[model samples]
Target chain A: MDQREQGKAIVITSGKGGVGKTTTTANLGTALALLGKKICLIDADIGLRNLDVVMGLENRIVYDLIDVVEEQCRLEQALIKDKRNENLVLLPAAQTRDKDAVSEEQMKELILKLKERMDYILVDSPAGIEQGFRNAIAGADKAIIVTTPEVSAVRDADRIIGMVEAEGVNDPDLIINRIRQDMVDRGDMMNIEDMIEILAIDILGVVPEDEGIVVSTNKGEPIVLSNNHKAGEAFNNIARRLEGEDVPLMDLNNSDSILAKFKKFVGLS
Target chain B: MSAVIKTKIEEQGVILSFNPDYCWEEITSALAEHLQEGAQFYQGSKLYFDLAFKDWRAEELQNLINLIESNILPETDFYFMNQSSGVERDNKATPKEQPFSPRSAQENKYTKTAGNDTKLIQRTLRSGQSIEHMANLVLLGDVNPGAEIKAGGDIIVFGKLMGLVHAGATGDKGAAITALQLAPTQIRIASVISRSPDEDKSKELRPERAYIKNNRIVVEEVNL
Candidate 1:
């Protein structure tokens, strides 16, 4: 196995549901693939399976994670190639089975086998800190916690961080998704600082609330693939950061005058 | 906090134990300092504490156990040899009385009382979760947010509070939250809410008490 092939497995998780864990995973995996890394995205949500659909690779699934774990299919038979990128792969979760069908050790072994060929293994964890969450984090060397700007989401993220820490994974990075900066400025929503004060972890990225993301999800394509979407650019920046590049965060202020947008359009950015 | 001398013997792989009353803070600090001074030399060394007259609660004992356990390599096993017969008896007695004696009467009185004294919790607070129970809201363990606990009367962490806390939520302000970790996300006593300063970050994680002062809550280092 190449050194990069023995890659770190990172589980993208949020303790609360509806906080965009699958969206972040698909976007990050796609963005990383665009950067020329061999990436495998595993949907560990089991019965609630959606990452495949979000990544636009649902129809290609024949064998799945449960199949590989149960010895009904080989590991390579389960990987669905991303239509947009040859280097990107998806290990779709079985939609018909419950989370208990796969054990933690089996999950670890599956990742270890994949590690021998992939540059990154991104496990999309299920919502709630239960058996599914534990299985997703079983083999991950790192974790990215996603939360919204609401008190409930932030609170759940905090709990997930503590659990991850107790599991001996220190310094899991934070990603505050769907942030409405306007609400933050108006004090109607919790600010990034409020979250950082409570989470006390290094932030990896911040994704603004973008209608384009919802539209793209509806169409079964992650917004990260589109160059025009601001959220796409943000995910790209996250990918660069993951590659150890110090990319400055995009200023999400909507007050950017027409002149600024015109300038950005002309590559004056 | 009194100072006590602790010695690590290479031959017996034992940490010479001193009485907890002999100044726990000093003794622990001194031992830590000594270990730091000879860190390279002491690396990979096993520690067996000679707990003779030392009396420690389960948490305190667990903390010490963790300290010794972490000091050694993962592959190496370590043990604390309790030399005193009374120490075991003391340890057993503490847990039985510690959780019950202080609150049994108060719990009875509160349950019997009604109305203005009632507390209500709307949702499950996860770990890291904290709530200022302005009255008497009881929760099953699920507060997951590095939470805070502030009650005007009594504060209980059904789950875990890895954040900040203040009991006496309404400023009966004389309230306290009892949890595995006294660390809270924020603490409120009556009209005042204060948080633990970032400066106290260290390995000395313990259950603590917080109270209100000139419109602010102050946390004091304490033992349960």
Candidate 2:
């Protein structure tokens, strides 16, 4: 059960807004915790803090990341425990202040402190290519680039990929979110190969554009908590891959024969 | 002037028909507005340049190419390289030292005219990376999206091309772009520019070459 290793900091960033950066952080954190690793999820979006709410720990947060950085609260005091899972913790951002509230130096020092106690530190970066992005990756050892299949999201993702690679973070893996298989089949959407030809990087996973993600998100419980949700399963697969497990990429393309059975089991079939 | 850029979505994909009659500025502005209105509708497709009748100038063509590129959705699996026809390109900017294939040069002298210096790159070009060659450029790997390859002469890729490529970067209309899988974000040849059709992987992938013909950019499948 002791899958603990030297803590690694990974920053999840999408240069475009609404490409599911916060959603990914919450799901991966919850999934890793379920896999028996102690993980700390940090919302680095500053005034746009969202990780706490996504993880359903919003009301429980008494102290935030800024409080810990300013020494107004201890690191342990700032972390809000997950109500559903005891192993996971949320070090959320301050909603009142902008990204300038936390300096890169302070964030790095805080990440170092968190490393001593947790196995993985996941930082959710804010949208746009600016100071918030720099502060988010300043202390990370690896990066995860998230993008939707849309042109604007992909363009911003490419810019973010260049920025992260320039920052000397380890090879950043790409996650193509909100991929609609039907659209791909109908010649209206970009498929995995099409995206690979452009991004030219190892893919982490692809999450189908699922209404379930929005539903689960609004419920304040990550989709990863539900086994039936394909997006949730994909997020779980990402967590396993992050643990250095060689998980096969989930075929999000409409091969529902195997998937439907995997999700629904009964004597009626 | 407002009718300079005409668009049609056919079974092959979207065809952006540029009217060579209008000046570059009018055409560029109209094209920008057209693309902005349909970016979502054109997200994953490549567009063809119907440039068959226009007399293209290298500088004006370059500006037109840049304008199309600046307006489209560059990411999202969309590309702009196409093989059209009937347009004549300006081939006046060939460099002095193109000798990569002396044996083939004689055969190409009358037909494949352009470029002297040839740069061969052997690795995948990732996003945001740009490769510029004053003469001819040949890459052996995939040119990913957000990355661009600009050559003053001809550009060739041995693998997939899904990025921005400007052949005849210095305005040689005789320049052509060839790729094993010739789908790019945008393509510029001499002074004629065109975007790729929306990418649809379900189609059989083939090696195709794009060059100007009859004053238009045309794409034809190549055996070798």
For model 2, the superposed segments whose C-alpha errors exceed 4 Å read A1-4, A255-269, B1-224
Tens digits of lDDT, candidate 1, A116-198? 88889999999999999999999999999999999999999999999999987779999889988788888898887789999
Over the stretch A66-133, how does candidate 2's per-residue lDDT look in tens digits?
77876657889988788888888889787655787688899899888888888899999999888999
Distance from true location, Cα of A201 in model 2, Å: 1.4
User: CA lDDT of B224 in candidate 2?
Assistant: 68
Which one wins on TM-score?
1
Report the CAPRI category for model 2.
incorrect
lDDT of 1 at B107: 47
Q: Can you give the DockQ of every candidate in the order shown?
A: 0.01, 0.01
Distance from true location, Cα of B200 in model 1, Å: 60
lDDT of 2 by residue, B82-187 (tens): 2343222322233332322233233333332232336789999876477865457899999975467876568899999987777765445677889989887667
